[model samples]
Target: MWVADYLSLLITCQAMSQSDMEGVEQCFLDISVDQVLHYDGVPAVEPWATMYIDAIHDKRFGDAIWARYQIFGDVVDGLIDDGRLTVLESIEEDAVGYKKNAPEAFDEAVAFYKSVTNSADGHPEVIEIIMRIDKEDVSNRYFPEGG
Candidate 1:
């Protein structure tokens, strides 16, 4: 079921002729931050969050690291305000891990996230995770780019 949704995301992107995979951004926005966390299989399924950031051209994999960054500020706020995490926890503790594909993309996303929101000043925990590269413990899926 999850794989189908993941594939659907890809097919939707392809059908829309999104070469750079802009569909990821749109899809994440469509799915909503709350929905993303509701899925227990997100860690096992949403493995592409950063799985293929390096070879942006074609590497058999893609994820919405960019959009995640866009919405992470809110995610952080919600989690922290709810007392789920402390002000010292990192993104790695959020239970969601990107495949660490393109660390730079994560960086750029963090920059964008911070620029638009007060997340940086609101909570250090949010800042710690959103800005983290988190290349240490992440799964990298190698799905065929054109497959």
Candidate 2:
């Protein structure tokens, strides 16, 4: 799912209360650190914007798997746009890092992400966004792995 789609869960929350924050913690599941960086300046959908800003600023979330998972989601989205993955989804806690089948694009995404994460000038990890048209299952697999 795209960041905008993932943020839908946050919009459903009534307010930025503790429970609300707790409820939408997983909403951060499928977005990128790069995307979250822009939320501060861009007008967002209510409590989601407030929540994301706070979440990204948290050192623990920013440095750990939470952020990685979020960015992975973006990477997967990017890969899909690039034609690497056929499909991706969040299938509970058991299946970490959603994937349909193995694809080389996953490696590329991970490599870049890890490279930037471990690099000195990486904090503001930025990723390219590709706009893709939805296609059927039959021919989708033949697509390339980048925009």
Candidate 3:
């Protein structure tokens, strides 16, 4: 499933018309993966709060990183309620801090998520995973182990 998603993300980007791919921010599209979660069969599935946090490790997307973290918090909150995945105690602290510092960035993050997930078919799920993993890389910068 993960491989399918990964390939889908790559193929989707490749299939995207030049203008469509160009519309995507080069920074958001940075091709990096969190090595911690990239191992085979990690069961690294949903409520992907950690992945979202990890993505912001890059300073180039400073505010955007914070924004994606915030958005992940919101999604995780809902997922927790829905019995999807347990929220990690460590990230809960950062999520609180992010909410206080960058409320608007969080909003933008949610919009970013919706925009990416609510798209064309084919490799849609792959795109979602890519976004989740990329967002996590950004958030990892705040975590001790992530650095």
* Highest TM-score against the true fold, candidate: 1
29-142 per-residue lDDT for model 1 (tens digits): 223222343443333133323322321223221123322433334345534424554333324443223325545555555555455433223234444455553434445433
- Per-prediction TM-score to the true structure, in the order listed: 0.26, 0.23, 0.24
Tens digits of lDDT, candidate 2, 6-65: 686575443234432322223223343334444533334434444444554442232333
Off by over 4 Å in 3: 1-87, 111-147
Report the poorest 10 consecutive residues by lDDT, candidate 3.
21-30
Question: Tens-digit lDDT track for model 3 on 35-116?
Answer: 2134232333334424332333322233323333333345454344234433333234344334445645544544565654
Scored by lDDT, model 1 comes in at 0.37
Candidate whose lDDT is highest: 3
The candidates, ranked best first by lDDT, are 3, 1, 2
C-alpha lDDT of all candidate models, in order: 0.37, 0.33, 0.38
| Lowest-sum lDDT 10-residue window in model 2 | 127-136
Model 1, which residues run further than 4 Å from truth? Answer: 1-30, 33-90, 93-99, 119-122, 132-147
- Estimate candidate 2's alpha-carbon lDDT, on a 0 to 1 scale: 0.33
Instruction: Estimate the TM-score for candidate 1.
Output: 0.26
Worst 10 residues of 1 by lDDT: 54-63
